[model samples]
Target chain A: MKLSIDRQIYSDACISKVVYWLSAQYAIERTLDGTIETLSISRNDGHPFDETELRSQCLRLLNDYKLRQTIDDETRDIRTILYAKAFADDENLTVE
Target chain B: MKYYLLPFKFTRIGDHEVFVNEVGDMLHAPIGTAEQIVNRTIEDPELYKSLVANFFISEIRIPALLDVYAERLAEKKRFLDDYTALHIFVLTLRCNQNCIYCQASSRDEHCAASSMSRENMRLAVQHMFKSRSQYLTMEFQGGEPSLEHDLFLYGIELAEEINQTEHRHLTYVLCTNSINLTDEVMATCKQYNVLISTSLDGPSWLHNQNRGKQDSYEKVVKGITKAREILGADRVSALMTASELSLNYPIEIVDEYHKLGFTSIFLRALNPYGKATDNADWEAYTNRFIEFYKQAFEHIIELNKQGHVMIEEYAAIILRKLLTPWCTGFVDLQSPAGIVNSVLIYNYDGYMYASDESRMLAEENDFTFQIGKLSESYENLVYSPKVKEWSKVWNNEAIAGCSDCALQAYCGADPVRNHSTQGDLYGFRPTSLFCKKNKAIIEYIISCVIDRYDELMPIFRNWIR
Candidate 1:
């Protein structure tokens, strides 16, 4: 169920593209049946709230979810993109 | 060994540089050494290459040496073979809002019928069509073009009719406040394909501070939203006039544009002339605008990695010319004097100025470059000695730093702006307010590209190739 990135070149400032890919990978990992533990990560503990209860107290998208939650073991496009951004100043992107 | 005297064409690249053939795409020339004759002469390699390229592409040796990069060399040699006027007539002197640094002063409430006569309009349009140039563009500008709605309508109709009948490629553009764009006006613009440009000095608080009859920012945003819905975002654009207040918080301007969904920004520096000449505060603001421009361009490029496609006009202009073969048609960038020679101005009274910023120099009936009246034909105005003077400066203006600077390749010594600030056409601006700001901005820009180059390589390659 992992994404195939062999033919696809990775690394860009494409945040939306990366996010969507992450979402898809998360879904695919959960649907794979063996990765239930990875998909269960959350920033906020589930709790009930009243109108006065600040919305910030409730959880939203989990940022620290395991990589296996999105991509299969073989796919590294998202990782490549992140690494590229992190190490942006060091490399000459043009193959020349 | 250097034979050619004045008009030096080639610059030395490290020890025998190469270029691609004529008429090909701006295809990257694969670097390779030419099989030269086993040389008996001893000389510098870079200088030798420069000389060889010149003589190779010279008129005397057309067939053999003029094989690669030759036609392109010729094209560059004759950059402005066609001189056409992208005439923008400021149709009205009347504007509703009072902006603090109003270059076209709102002081002239005595509206003077504030509109071009039907007769003058007819003459201007007719003169436009009669030109033998490849492309003709007519842009309508004003305190607010929409303020003179009937005159604008009249002028647009004339432009459309002439283009249809006379059969010339025409680009019709308008700069307005967007306050007066009614559905009728929008419909006419849509039908005729008029590119609409508006002004937004900054965000709500700052914009209202600078320009307000009513809440100017909301009004401008309303105008942009309404017009963009009608004319489409691609055809609708905005410009900013920087003031001291917005200088420190330049990101606010960029963020404001982003909030409004504009994909690009001119980050226009405030002019130091016109009613604004007294505003010494604007110099500080201009510097701030340049600083913000560098930061915003970097931020936008970073965001581009996150999937946003944004370009700053200043960066975009340099990048377009440096990386691509197709020209941006910016007036100042071309080699053969690109002022009144490339674009001219016809004011509302059929009075002409050689450059747009000419009348902005002094106050109370004192202006510099009222070169001719619009009643004169295009041929007459273009060939005038005033224009000849500007064209001569096309090589290197009488400016101080620009004429001698190494980076003149990437900059424009605007004599018109110089003439506006100082008493001379080649104003003492290298030391003045404008030059300091540009030097800082240009150096900062070069650093940014050179710094985070790894992140840029992918994007740069895609754009260049």
Candidate 2:
């Protein structure tokens, strides 16, 4: 099964995570051409592949990860501050 | 109209999208709620207020209550501050009863060279004090620790002698099969106020079948009765393991615990070690255990409704995680993966292991988790290179599949389990039984909260209380 994901819609990190999870059952090969990333996935057990099911699953995961990435990007500084304030010796963690 | 999104994860549970915040507080909303939150289109005033109040969003660039949020996050992980509190002392590997699925890899009753030496016990006690945790739990585990009664007493007495100056609050626990709680063991246990944690796998037929002895259940009941008379009823607790046969009778197991006067039962699953490694299919076993857990949990709830008063311990742990901001002391279900952070094992083989299962792994001569010898410095053993390698994969926040999991806050990472089962410390989460079981059970508990709120909350609140 070949999945061509547009980099504009999903970051490489998001797509990579989806592939990493599927890697347990499938041997996935990745190639990036400009803004398009393709995942050539094959079953590890040599069973017949369901391209539609696989594609839908990947799309769902990509969407979820993209939203998660947005949250991470928006909250990165606050999360760092949160940890620093929680654990670090210095208590003042006001962002200037 | 406009608000900044805080870090949270969402997943579809039945018809609703359940959003869990950074600290594990959950809120159920409509299907497109997360999309609305992210796209700045939340229309419901109540939800908007809830999102802000629950630390899921901020009206300002940084919420004024960020300090409170940080403190809650800190409290959720405060177990790290306590360092290693639960120190397991493996007294011996000589068990009288031969269990069908013995995770401890017990040997014959006459097995020599398989017990902790007195010098090693003394050193282990000294090592326990080295931990700065104000409260120390010295747990004696075995192939039936009662088999080595003298060693057990010596260990407790040695801890007492040293604790005179150390001044730490000490708790002693004896993990024994109730079949052999002799008068001597009972007396020592009484003097130290040691809590007796014994194994009881269900009714007589089921329990004996699991234990591989026809008369085992009769002896166990007799021993339990004896222990309760000597020690208080509250001090004697029993845990049941779901063997292959026991899976056929979840209600029977729960009823057996209730019948024996146990208010709570930890419905434990078989670990992948010792004789339990003989399980033909773990995926099938895990699937069955999930169903078994749900069925038994439903039965427990019904029992509670009947005024029987029973708590399913696994649910209580997950409930405490879900409903409260406090972290539980369950080593298996902790992030930063409990190994040395919350527990350390002093094996009878004169070596220090990362956990109880680590020592069990050593029985098969796989010492991957063996930290060092009892003779080694606490600093050297705890901070050894092996432990350093383990720390790399111990945090679920950093692991691949777990990093993006909607249920990550309620789940934990287990590098030792990963290593033992998957041949690596970083396991494949897609095929992880640990991940599957925890996610299913936690999600089921959440479903109960969503669908049967009024019916189950009273029972749940009492369990956590």
Candidate 3:
């Protein structure tokens, strides 16, 4: 199955994360065009796979990873402070 | 209204969005509710109140209970406070039965060379006492531990003798095939109050097929019954590994346990180690096992409804993580990759290994996880440079793929597994079998709780207890 995903719509990192997951079942190849990225996927061992199902899974995973990226972007600083507070032993430490 | 978004992630589960926070607090809300939280457009006052109350969203710069939350998080990870509590002693690699999926590579029963020496056993027990843990579990494992009667007895007797003066709470467990539960073994168990952990795959035919012995099931059942009679039924427990053949008979397997009057079953998966590495396709096997587990778990729930006290132990472990503020003592599901943290292995070869699987990898001549020799001092063994290297990738919150996962709170890190399976200490979660199996099961459990909320709560409550 070949998918031409819009680069603007989904970040490359998000697509890569999804492809990494599906790589166990599918041999995925990615190529970038000017504004579009194409993913060429085939069964890993020449076994049977449902093309429609794979497409749905890839799209769903892409959306999920995008959400994760957003969360990572939004909470980066606060998460660091939380960890520092949880593990740091210095009583004089301050997070500003 | 201004809202401060606490760290959380949401996934669609059967028409509902399940939100899980950093501390594993979960709430299932209607679809698009996740969007509402991100967009700050939550219209329902009660839903917004729940989000704030559960640490999903905060109204202030930090929640008023930030210190309390931090304390609770530290308490959940209390396993790291103790040096090590579970000490496994691999008595020998000699065995009587050739199991189809034996993770421990076993030699023939008469292979005296594979057995742990008396000197090694004494040194290993002495080394176990060096840990400052108030409680200790000295677990005896083997190709068939019962075959090495003298070594098992020696190890236990040494621990018991030490505990007399040391006064640490000590418990002994014998992991055996149960085929060789002779009277001598039973007598020792009775004397020491040793708990018997045995293996029973399924019905007679299935068990025999897996064991490669026609009379294997009969011997095991007879041995289990005898041990139960001697040590009391509560002291004997059985765990089953779901092989390819066993996948086809999930109901029969649970029914078999019920017939044997066992109250709980641990549905374990096959690890890629020793003889079990011959498994051709793990992706297909993983999918099959997930299906098998769901079916078997439902059957267990049905059994509970039918007035039987049946529990699925794996689900119980997950429930403890999901429904309670406490963390489970199950090493496999721990953050820091449980190896050398919660449990350590004193191998038959006079070496201290990171985990049970660490020694199995050694049987194949791979020594990535060998901590040190048994003769080494406790300080040198634990604080060695090799262990220092492992510490970097052992925490799930610090690892790739896992760090971003919403189920991160419920899942754990497995550096040994990553080193063995993926050839890296830091695993890639997208292609990780450990991640796949856990996420599927945990998500399915959450979905079940949402889909059958009122009907299944009582059943789930019973299982977790």
Regions more than 4 Å wrong, model 3 = A1-19, A22-63, A89-96
- Compose the digit string of candidate 2's lDDT tens values, residues B1-465: 788888888998999999999899999998888888998999999999999999899999888988889889999999999999999999999999999999999999898888999999998999999999998999999898999999999999999999899999999999989888889999999999999999999999999998889999999999999999999899999999999888999999999999889999998999999999999999999999999999999999999999988989999999999999999989999999999999999989899999999999998899999999999899999988889988999999999889878888888999989989999999989989999999999999999999999999999999999
Estimate every model's Cα lDDT from 0 to 1.
0.56, 0.92, 0.88
Q: What is the lDDT of residue B411 in candidate 1?
A: 54
**Native RMSD of candidate 3 (Å):** 2.9
Residue A96 CA displacement from its true place in model 1, Å: 36
Q: List the candidate 2 regions with Cα displacement exceeding 4 Å.
A: A94-96
Better candidate number, 1 or 3, judged by TM-score = 3
A63-85, model 1: which lDDT tens digit per residue? 11121122222223322432343
Better of 1 and 3 by DockQ: 3
What TM-score does chain B alone reach in each candidate, compared with the true chain B?
A: 0.81, 0.99, 0.98
RMSD of 1: 22.0
The digit string of per-residue lDDT tens for model 1 on B60-132 reads 2222332233334434423355555577776776777787777765444456776667777777777666656
* CAPRI class assigned to model 1: incorrect
lDDT (0-100) at residue B219 of candidate 2?
Answer: 97
User: Per-residue lDDT of B280-366 in model 3, one digit per residue for the tens?
Assistant: 998889999999999999999899899999989988888888898887888999997788888989999999999999999999999
- Model 1 stretches with alpha carbons more than 4 Å out: A1-96, B1-70, B74-79, B107-110, B281-286, B362-364, B397-400, B459-465
Full candidate order by TM-score, most accurate first:
2, 3, 1
